[model samples]
Structure formats: structure tokens, C-alpha cells
Target: MPQPVIYTHQLTRKFGDFVAVDAITFEVQPGEIFGFLGANGAGKTTAMRILCGLLSPTSGQANVAGFDVYRQNEEIKKQIGYMSQKFSLYENLTVRENIQFFGGIYGLSRQELKDKTNVLIDRLGLHNEANKLVGALPLGWKQKISFSVAILHRPKIVFLDEPTGGVDPITRRQFWDMIYEAAHDGITVFVTTHYMDEAEYCDRVSIMVDGAIAALDTPAGLKKQFNATNMDEVFLQLARGAKRGD
Candidate 1:
């Protein structure tokens, strides 16, 4: 069997007296779509930042793409792509130019950047809008383009932080299709979403409630364990009993 692509053991983080990530442990396999789910203030952000090497944990260990998050953050950064909720493209830059700038940041050569840009534009069916400013594009197109840019350098894992925050349901479904394609091609995706149905699409999901993972299992398993019919019920079963201020 292959080793896990991401490994975390008792990983923890604290802000003053508050425990933001409370000794959580989990593993992610290569080519897996791992869903990280939680509500506001659930500490999902803290855990993700720690894994992405953007924030240091107060205790425990994590290895992302075989590099230690604590001591080998720079190496980890090179092996991972990140997309946040907001559109990350430069508004003034054209669709093609946004790709060029991000690709260049990854240290791609001029030829490599040009090749990748063309491929991305073609793949996203943005040939007609390739020269248009990103600001002028609609939300769904920008979302697709940003996702394409995130994977341009072929990072082993992509971390998506609420990548479909404000989009309509149809757009979100289309976005998940893009995610499936990326995962099928061997890029492990670590995503967090409030959309329970989206969690259903994951190979496995972990529900975080107030800084701790309350449940970790496949969608069916979780629903079965909770005696629920859907992810929304499963999530609520675990998270609903929590005290508000904790």
C-alpha cells in the first residue's frame, strides 16, 4: 500500500488560553479529495494554515508532501497550491496575464509560463476572453480561471479555502467538477466548505466543532453512524450540542 500523502499526529495550535486546534490527528492519501468542514469559529482555518505552513502549531507534528510543516515550510510551500475564498487574480491583468504572473511566481521559465498559460486558457475555454481583463469577467469564469491558475505549476496538493463561497448552486457544482478533474489527475485536494452536499462529494470528510474534529469518516459512514440521511444531519448531530462560547 502507498504511504499517506499528508500526515498529522496530535497537531495542535493555541491562541493565548484558547485552543484553536486541539491535538487533531488525520491522514490523507494521494489523489484523494479530503473535505475539511466546519462552521464559523470552528478552528478549520487554524488547522489548514498550520498544514499549509503559514502558521506554526503549538504542539504535535504534520508532514505535507513528505516535508515537515514546522521545519520545512518553504519546501512544503513549493509542493502545494492554495486558493482562498476571494478571487486571487489581478483585476487589471488580462486572463492570460494573470496566469503568467502566477506561473512566474512559481519559478516557471518564460517558455514554461507561455505553454502553461495557453493550455490553461484552452482548457478553461477562455480563448475568446484570454485578452480580456479579469475584472471584466463574470464571477463563475473568474472562479474557474483562478482554480486553473492554482494548479498551473502542478503542485502535488491544492488547499482550497471555501473556493465557492458566494457562487450559486449551479456554479458550485461546476466548480466541484473541476475539483474532481484535478483529483483524478493525481492532485490531492484539501478543501473546507459549509455546504454539506459538497462534503458528500469528498472521499472522506472531517467535521470540526470548536477546534476539535468531532467526526471523521466517509459520507455514508458518517450518515450511518449518526443515523442520518445526509451530511447536514451528520454534521449537526456532532456539532449541535457544543456550547456557544467554547
Candidate 2:
């Protein structure tokens, strides 16, 4: 059987009287792309933060890459990579410079960094733009570079928070292809997105509403269970059910 890369049991987070995530339980298997779906303020980010060891859960347990999030945060950090919704590259730096900077921070040697940079630049088709300033690159290119930098350390799990936000449809598709390639190479991807079409690309998906998981299944399973033709309908129905306190 495949081992779980992420496991959470009744994981909850609270801020004062407001609960950000409420007793959420789930597991993501190795090499799977697990999509986390939710409306804004639906606790998706909060849950992801906890899983990434950026924040502590208020209660329950979370194990990432076989390390307890609360007790082995440092180990967890080393095993996971995170790409936020916002592109997080230095706009003033060139593409190669950005790669070098990130790789250095991850303790990579100069020779190793140079080799990886060359491979990445070629793989991402950024050979011609390697010397171009990141700020001058198109939004799609910047996003792609940011994603590449995030995984520079070759982490076991990569968490992406809306990694493909405002790009064109073609760019979005390309980004997903990159994600699939990463997963195929044995990296587990956990992501959050509002795009139903993108959600369908995931091997499994979990929908959050009002700080709890309202639905969890493969895309086909969700569609069948909700008797919906698509993920959007399933999401809408689940969201409405949550609002009605059902």
C-alpha cells in the first residue's frame, strides 16, 4: 500500500472565539495531487498553514512526511515546499539570479546550484530569458519561476496556495502540466484553488465550508454523490448546505 504523505485527524484551529478550521480530518497519499477547494474565508489557507508547519493547530493532530507538525516542525519544513498565491520572487533579480539565491538559502553548493539552474532554465524554456529581470517577465513566466524556486530543495511534498491565480487559460494548463510532471516524479502536491476545472485535475479533492470538510472524494465520486454534472455544481450545493446549517 502507498504511504500517506499527509495525515490529519480532527485538526482544528481557532483565533479567540472564531474557529478557522474545525475538526478536519484527511490524508493525502504519496505522488497524489490533492486539491483543497473552498470559498474565500472557508479555512483553506488556515488548514494548509497548519499542514505546512507555518501555524500550530489548536487541537488534534497533523503528521507531514511522517513528522509530527507540532513536535517536529523543523523536520517537516525540510520535507515540504510552499508556494503562496502571490509570486514571491525578487523582481529586481534576473531569472538565474533568483534561482541562485533560492538555492543558496536551501544550502545548495555553488556547483549544485549552477547545475540545477541550467537544467531548470532549459526545462522551463527560460533559456533566452535567463538574464532578464524577473520584474520584466510576463506574469505567467514569473509564476512558473516562483514554482520552480519553491521546489529547489526537492521536497517530498509541495503546498501551493492558488498557484495559478490570474494567468490565461493556456498558462493555467501549462502550470498544471508542470504540477503533473512533479507528481509523476514522486512529489506530492497539495493545492487550493477556486477553479473547478483545475480541481478536476487533482487525483482527489476535499471541499471546505464554514471551517469543515463538507465533501471529500475523487472528482467523479463527488459528481456522482452530489448527482451533479460538474465540480462547480457539487461545490455550490455543498456550500449552500453549509450556509443552511445542514
Best-matching candidate per lDDT: 2
Looking at model 1, residue 211 earns an lDDT score of 87
How badly does each model clash, as a count of residue pairs? 0, 0
- Candidate 2 per-residue lDDT, tens place, 1-246, comes to 777999999999999998889999999999999999988888988998888888999999999999998999888988988887674799999999999998898778999999999999999988899999999998888888998898888999999999998999999999999999999999999999878999999999999999999999999999999999999999999887665232
Lowest-scoring 10 consecutive residues by lDDT in candidate 2?
237-246
What TM-score, to 2 decimals, does candidate 2 have? Answer: 0.96
TM-score of each: 0.97, 0.96
Residue pairs in candidate 2 whose N, alpha carbon or C atoms collide under 3 angstroms: none
Candidate 1 shows a clash count of 0
Model 2 alpha-carbon drift over 4 Å, by segment: 244-246
In order, the Cα lDDT scores of the candidates are 0.90, 0.91
